[model samples]
Target chain A: MKKNILEISSFSNEKLKYISGLKEKKNREKSGTFFIEGFREIQRAQISGKVKFEYILTCPDCYLGENEEDLVSSIDAKTILVPKQIFEKISYRDRPDGLIATAELPDFSLSSKTKLSDDPILVIEGVEKPGNLGTILRTAEGAGFHKVFVADPRLDLFNPNVIRSSTGTLFTLDVFQSDIKELYPILKNAGYKTFAVTPEAKSLHWDADLKGKVALVFGSEQYGLSEYARSQSDQYISLPMKGVADSLNLAMSAGILMYEVLRQKSQIDN
Target chain B: MKKNILEISSFSNEKLKYISGLKEKKNREKSGTFFIEGFREIQRAQISGKVKFEYILTCPDCYLGENEEDLVSSIDAKTILVPKQIFEKISYRDRPDGLIATAELPDFSLSSKTKLSDDPILVIEGVEKPGNLGTILRTAEGAGFHKVFVADPRLDLFNPNVIRSSTGTLFTLDVFQSDIKELYPILKNAGYKTFAVTPEAKSLHWDADLKGKVALVFGSEQYGLSEYARSQSDQYISLPMKGVADSLNLAMSAGILMYEVLRQKSQIDN
Candidate 1:
């Protein structure tokens, strides 16, 4: 394991300042780096080999055990030991788990030969909430989708909050940043049917032909799918609402779409 | 509008103490009350008539305008103005939005004919996160699920966090607490298929018959479905996982199952 080097005493430590500033979207973009907190998430990042860690910060009293230390060693990150109070000040959670990592963002790009199976591909547009984006990524990964393309990813994928909300699946999945305008041609050329998930659509999600190579598009909660995204799609589908609530959360909508694809693919495979 | 009665100055105010205590489940249970912050949420609660408020606390500077005051006045809640700092102390969110309502918990009980429709029901077992519960409720409401039977709900229904996460859908849906054992016979007699959602299940979610009246069961992240809940289920179904991740979040799983049912029912209807 990497030996502890720096003893961070203040929140204004250069690294600490950089990490705290990453909580905002602009800072993350400018730095080309982000933070992932908690032991489990950092371990996942280490195992995935996609993240390049600059350093790890931990409390002296509750340092990572040998097994965890071994995992951290493989990633080649510098280690720092800090007081518990210092750790707490930098933590986003109510209880800091005494472990945090600063890692280089994964350089992701969509594959030229996009795999279009019978299962539907999830296309997220302008998803604002980090938790919602992370949950959708976790769901997309779990449902066995080949790719989860973020068409205009609003939040940083490597945000500590996103990593926590995703339960570390963000470390494993294929996530790319692109807009609907750029992605539309690729989807259409691939012969995949595109379905924009919206509330105002006349047909229900089930009515759509989800069994084919499909790209299921979802938009922001405040505004549904953009006009451009909707126009480019082959079909528009919606979840039926029997209650007074106007719309479902973006992540939930994506989850429903992913599962519908799962359901259809399973039937065809069988 | 209800006239502002007290200008809260101290942190030790009885009302502030009560609202702050809601951070713990035990306190909420003992007091039979919880906090609901945000203007839209409080407005929804008032419109639903599910919760009776003891008081509405807000910063005087951020208090509603005369037009907004007219809307608040009709709610019949006792209004109180507090310093922004005092309001911030008791508020869970970073920005309080100048509204926090102390609301008595609704007496939630399963209806005798709890089967609201031939469409599916969602049964969540031992879900620990209020955000997950709220997201599931939002999805259930959007998917046109007849009722959501929260089996062994770990968090209180009136949790301010849940209300916020749900985007006010909690006010418009039928949410109640009951045991899995209590629900089994009723679901069976109603000719509903009870599908326990697990990663180890033999059948994929799509391969299962979700068209009829169905009850999709989900469990906590730490534990899969409870032994009792698993035993009582008619069958177990899983979403296919291609990635290294074993499972999706509880709310995501519920969303997928809910939408799958919607898809099936729509096909049949069409």
Candidate 2:
């Protein structure tokens, strides 16, 4: 056992209760902390230095991989050892990796304290599913997007599903959440050409000059960009719909649009 | 009740047992029928005229939409009426639209009878998740690809999640599934330059000549294309991974690559 490790014997321990409490949005808000599970997610969070984890729970016995002990020793936070049963009780995953940590939620508001970037930004509006938001973040990273902003999100930004699906890019990327009113000014001041994605748009996505600084907005398939979002956006662009499916999945839309920006900027066009 | 409608009140009714039993893959294969839910999905399946629905279960009591009776009226299949409790019992969705149908699974094997499209083909290899397959189908439709072939799929072709996530594109799109050996010859004979998508590949996807007849194969992120798949492909191509994320989500990768093919072919490139 590590120097800081303390074994958790009972299921009803306060740490176990606290770790599970972050599952609820209200508890996370009140406590100002959310939970991070999985080995890769914690490592990314640690390297990013954007958020602080108060402590972590590790069940070496339940671990699937050989590196759990090494990762525990590397982090600056306190580590609490756990039995397999107790770890499984607090875990969100079907196959637990034997690591769970309570992390202080970063301030996602567009305040002066927040670091803004010149790299192409991806914005999602009213994302209804955590999986969609997580995927967009991962896609955004793959497409070289440095920053992402969510406007009027339906799911909590720190939802564990988001972290799980993102494969930890949620920590590596600059993720911010704010309402529509708070969103546009930052992009405008940053001199970003905001492209509002809609199926009804006149300009096809590839037709738009996505080069230079830009922010791409994706909305729900059922209800597109809010009236306010449409109004704030500089251009209305759409992916070409050739077959019966009128809209691509929300994450898929983000992937296509984000890459289009990269494709235009990379001097690799036709 | 309509002329062919039968009310199912008892939970132990054979009709109810039979409906719920299709959840298992063996049952779906044995009975050769899978379930679909949602109004928009059913409407699309009806219009596609490809697969045949054996029957539909409807709960007028639990209906959130006003158009259930009208949709039930249009289909030729027998309608089984159920109370709210029974509808919820057999439902895969959190909120059932009061419509669930057992549609005969179309033979997905690539045989001489299979319809081939000159349009760009999208093939997924060893897909581990139904959601990824479903999203790829939806994206393929939006990107104008008419046919989708799955090779060595881990999940069943007609998995309920695939149907749910595809939003009934499963019916509208010509879907075929076969082993890796059965796949290559069809593409080879069709004169397609198969682009095998792997992160390790030298040629970027956009840089590839996606013009005319092409088949793009996306593999699992953890496991790239099987040895036979790599050996069979005409070109190994990759999406530019610019940031910390080593790979995009399987569906997102499909979305990006599918759009790239469309982007190059449509004369929309820079």
Candidate 3:
């Protein structure tokens, strides 16, 4: 396949500006697109076959895989070539992997037949940190969760940091963007118990029946689970903290809770 | 109690340079001190009473405490009166809380008779990310682990990000640093069934006997557990990934494993 490498010399280049604007949640939603950078992340996106690649931009020396080429051909996106220096300027990290791909948001709908087994679901509410969100997605995937529904996510789901932090797991997971009101009904209808994780909760997390089809709810680090979300939850559960710390990080809580679900499921299966 | 407010107007302030340098691990070790910023974190340090506070710098308008005069009189440290602008410059976060305290590193050594439960211990190896390290500490503390030991930590425990991420639990928990080789004797002596968490591991995480006195080891995100660490382990355990993503983040894995330990213990306890 013949490739056209377009050198992005100016930061004012329309494409560069568009990609840069994606760092903001508003811009990503406005364009109905998000940017996923780095060679590894782009490769994961391609392998997942969920996101539609608008274009793949990389330095002259970078290799584009056959799958990537097929994706480019299928989407009719011109593989824009970027100078190394220009790519560095647009990259998020200190060292640019020399690859960035603009991808259309995957069309995701919460499955009506969402399986609620002994394994619990992880529900995130208003998670602000991109890295925390990404880490949670990666953890959920590792803990055997098939779906992660973001209820009123404060940051853009496709933020480059989120992509990098998730180690590209975000590309493969079922990530739904909706308000708690929208998600609560679906979870309830699916017969999934919702447990809101909070410091003020009287019951310890271990005391909760995590073996059931459950959705573990967490909020931002600052305000914790929102009052509305907390009120809507089936129960409030907390980790047993003997130390001086008040609460765990959003991702850590999700990881602990998801694994609890897995542990319970394994015991049941045995 | 008369409080002296030191207003640091110049960037050339030696104290400012010293505090900023604490951001690096080398500088922190060389100086034998680290800075904890923000009101809540500083309060946590005071409550834990693990680390000695060398000094407290804050704006007059900032709430020191209800008995501000009494609290200031109690500590034998010089109080610096800084303008909000000056504090903002020294602060790491965007909104400076007008409080930064220099703290001596706490002696985090485990006691000879440190209680070892039938549950597992988390040994974090070469985790570079402060947030990841902090999250792991928070989870370990929350999950009621016998103890958490940092095996070749890449980032200093006193890094502001680690302090913030752990919600100041770093000060209260039994967190000590050691190389991977040092853990083998300790595990053997303590009768811990050693398990290394790695993607290459054939045994699933659930397959391990987490209810026993197990020591679960994890490495950096960039590099999986060192070959030596892997070789020393009795068994290798990995989370079952149903998706295309190959690995989970280090902290997330730690959190999940910690909870698994908690789940097993809870089951046995009940």
Most TM-score-accurate candidate: 2
Q: Give the candidate number with the greatest DockQ.
A: 2
Better of 2 and 3 by TM-score: 2
Each candidate's TM vs. the true structure?
0.82, 0.95, 0.86
Mark the regions of model 1 whose C-alpha exceeds 4 Å error after superposition. A1-31, A38-40, A43-49, A57-70, A79-99, A109-120, A189-192, A211-213, B1-31, B47-49, B56-71, B80-99, B109-119, B180-193, B211-213
lDDT by residue for model 2 (A63-98), tens:
888888888888877788888888888899988998
Q: What is the alpha-carbon lDDT of model 2 when measured against the actual structure? A: 0.85
Model 3, span A167-244: residue lDDT tens? 788877767777788789878877888899998899987777788688899988677887788888999998766555
Provide the clash count, candidate 3.
Answer: 4
Kindly report the docking quality category of candidate 1.
medium
Candidates 2 and 3: which is better by DockQ? 2
> Candidate 3, residues B148-233: lDDT per residue as tens digits?
88888777778889998776667666677777776678788879888888887888877777886788888887887888987888
Per-residue lDDT of model 2, residues B1-270, tens digit only: 345678879989987898899977999988888878888788888888976988888888778878888888888888898889888989998888898888888777889887566789988999988888888887888888899989998888788888888888887888888888888898888777898999889888878889888999888655868999999888899889998666778888888888888888888334
Here, model 2's chain A TM-score works out at 0.93
Candidate No. with top lDDT:
2
Ordered by lDDT, highest first, the candidates read 2, 1, 3
Indicate the TM-score of model 1: 0.82
The 10-residue segment of model 3 chain B with minimum total lDDT is B63-72
